[model samples]
Every structure is written in structure tokens, then in C-alpha cells.
Target: MTTFTSFTFLLLPFVVFHVANAAIFDIRNNCPYTVWAGAVPGGGRQLNPGQSWSLNVPAGTKGARIWPRTKCNFDGSGRGRCETGDCNGRLQCQNYGMPPNTLAEYALNQFNNLDFFDISLVDGFNVPMEFSPTSGGCTRGIVCRADINGQCPNQLRAPGGCNNPCTVFKTDQYCCNSGSCGPTSFSKFFKDRCRDAYSYPKDDATSTFTCPGGTNYKVVFCP
Candidate 1:
């Protein structure tokens, strides 16, 4: 609930550009329970077992986040709240999700015509998730859909999720607010399990990944 910018410390491996890029996302939830999937730019939807949602992200969208909310109850008007990953207490999130949630992050058509993408646990995690570039010549997929909840540290454990160090402790040591922070035992806990995701600030060098421009992505929940 603190004021933190998502993917603020991310540094694109490609150069900056003006031309826009477009892509489609197939967000599928394989979990038995229903998940309220939310996105900053792409909107929100509910996915039940064996169900999926799709969205076409227009060119020029940046810093987009796709995440799932748990323990949510919505009314007919899409007005409601969630126990985890709640975005301003709404079913359709035009905003960012709360902490203690797993995140799929991306920026399309960045510098040098490359698209940057990653699965981020820096916000903590409620559910396991995978982010994969489906097309545009990407061979690697990013996933953090690990059983972190069952093994979450006592201090970091929340009602339905694990809290990132920065969210739970809110200290310079974990937050890297002074831009001097590095990996700690907590971040190591995440990195050890999800090697490709960002465990903390300054994790760009190895955690961030790139694909060619115009690449489509698939975000799978409970994968």
C-alpha cells in the first residue's frame, strides 16, 4: 500500500524509439479457483477453471502490468474488492494492483525495436504465474509460478500471499530507496526459486529479457 512505482528501476536493453508496436495477450488461468485478472492498460476479467481471456494491446503502451486478484467479490456493475492484488477496489483495474501480488511486466517496441518483458516478484506474490513471448522469435519464457506461499517466511507471509521485503519491512535495506541496495536473504528466497524474475531493485542486468518488436505474449496463471 506504500507509494512505489512498478518497474521503475527497469532499464531496457534496447534503444528508445518513436514508432509504436502492437501485440496480443492470451491470459489463461488453469487454477481450479476463479481468478480476477487485472491489467493497467488492457483492462480486467474473471477466469474460472479451464478459462482464458484475450486482449490486444495497442502500440505505444508502456509499463503495462498483468496480474490476478484473489478473494474478490464483485457486483453486477463490476464494483467490488479483493483480498489480494486489489486495484483500487474495482473489478476492472485502470490502476496498479496492491502489493503482495505476482506481476507480469512488459514494454513494447522499446529502443532498437526490442520488446522488454519479465515476471516480477518484487511486489511479492499471491499466485504462481508464467509470462511467455508466444511469437516474434523468442525462445525463452519467463515464469515465477512457484509454490512460494507454502514456503514463505513467517515474517513475509500475508493472508493470501507473500510480501516482498520492501512491502513488509519498508526499509532502505530492502527498498533500495537510496539506490544502493542489493540482494538480501529475502530477495535470495525469491531468486532461488524464480531465477528469471526480478528479486529486487537493480536486478535488471540478468532478470530483464528482450524479444523482437511486435511480439505477442501469453500470461498463464498457476502454471
Candidate 2:
């Protein structure tokens, strides 16, 4: 019993570290207008220009996406609407936003004890954005600052954003049928400009990136 107790004591620190291993995402808005930042499995906030909001995400959090909404009008009740990236007309979003919004996606503690992250245009594009792994073995942060809206393909242009082909067409060809399709001219259009983003269904080779778990990240708008 004495030996077992000593072994248990030795394992306590490892357990504590594993349980306490959390990733902090510091989201900043550098755009000229206010940004209603949204995250899943994480809450939402409004960040004015030069303002920053930080959220601590626990280790096991998965499939979390962060995006910014523009030109929002929220009353004292945190209920209102946004011009772009609005999430169910609520300020503190209880759900994901309607797309045509650039997405910064991450899943922590995935296979091989790594954290997978990417800037996904798969949802579409609203603002010039960036997602960087600020700490740990993540060096492939995506910076998608290209003016996709300014020069968006005429067919893919929306009011305040550029729509991805998948959103515009919604066909098996554009949506990829969950693994059995490929890119088209529209995906190539986004790929040619934003090389670090997901252009098509099978763009994981370059778009997806991984980091050692316990890494910290930052998502910036218009940066």
C-alpha cells in the first residue's frame, strides 16, 4: 500500500498538467469598423477597432470556429442584427453564423496529441482575416488578407462578402459530396489568391495545419 501511494503521488502532477492544458485564443479586430466576434464552444463579444477579446478554451474543445460580424446593431439585450456574419440575430451568439464569412477553425487534442487548425474559405469570405498559432510548434499560420470581396468573381459576389462556390452552387461538384468530388474554376479562383486557405474539398495538403497540443492561438481581423 505504501508503494502504491507513492506511485499515485508521482502521477498527480501529470494529471494536473493534462487537465489544466488549455489553449487561449486572443481575438483582435484591426478593421476600421466594429467587429462582433463569434466563436463556437466559446462565447462571442464585440470588439471595436484596436480592441481585443480573449477566451480560454479547454483542452478537449473540438470543432470550434471563430469569425467576425460587421455593422451590427445590438440593443441593451444583446439582441440585434448584423450586415455580415450575423449569428441568428443575437450579439452573444448561441449558434454559428450564416456564411459568406471567413472561418478560423481548430480542433484541439486531435489524433497524435496534436491540435489541428486552419483558415477555411469553405464557408466563404467576409473580411480579411488571419489565424496564427502564437505558441508551440505551429508555424503555418494562415493570413488571408486578399481583397476577395473587392475583386470577387461576379457570380460569387454577395452584398458585403464573397461567396464560396459550395455556398453558391450547393451541387455535388462544389460541395464535394463529403469526399468524392474535386475543385472547379470557382474554387481555383479562391485558391489562386488565398493559397493558405481551403480552396476545395481536398485542399488539406496545404490548408490544414497542426500544432503540438497546449499551444496558444490568435485570430485577427483585417490583418
The candidate that wins on lDDT is: 1
* Model 1 C-alpha lDDT per residue in residues 12-62, reported as the tens digit of each score: 543223234458899999888999999989779999988999888875567
lDDT of 2 by residue, 17-51 (tens): 86458899999999998888998867689999999
Report clashes for each candidate as comma-separated counts.
Answer: 2, 0
Which lDDT value does model 1 have at 6? 26
RMSD of each: 5.0, 7.2
lDDT of each: 0.84, 0.82
After the best TM-score superposition of candidate 1, give how far the Cα of residue 14 lies from its true spot, in angstroms: 19
For candidate 1, which ten residues in a row score worst on lDDT?
1-10
* Colliding residue pairs in candidate 1: 15-111, 16-111
The C-alpha TM-scores of every prediction are 0.90, 0.90
Q: What is residue 73's positional error in candidate 2, in angstroms?
A: 1.0
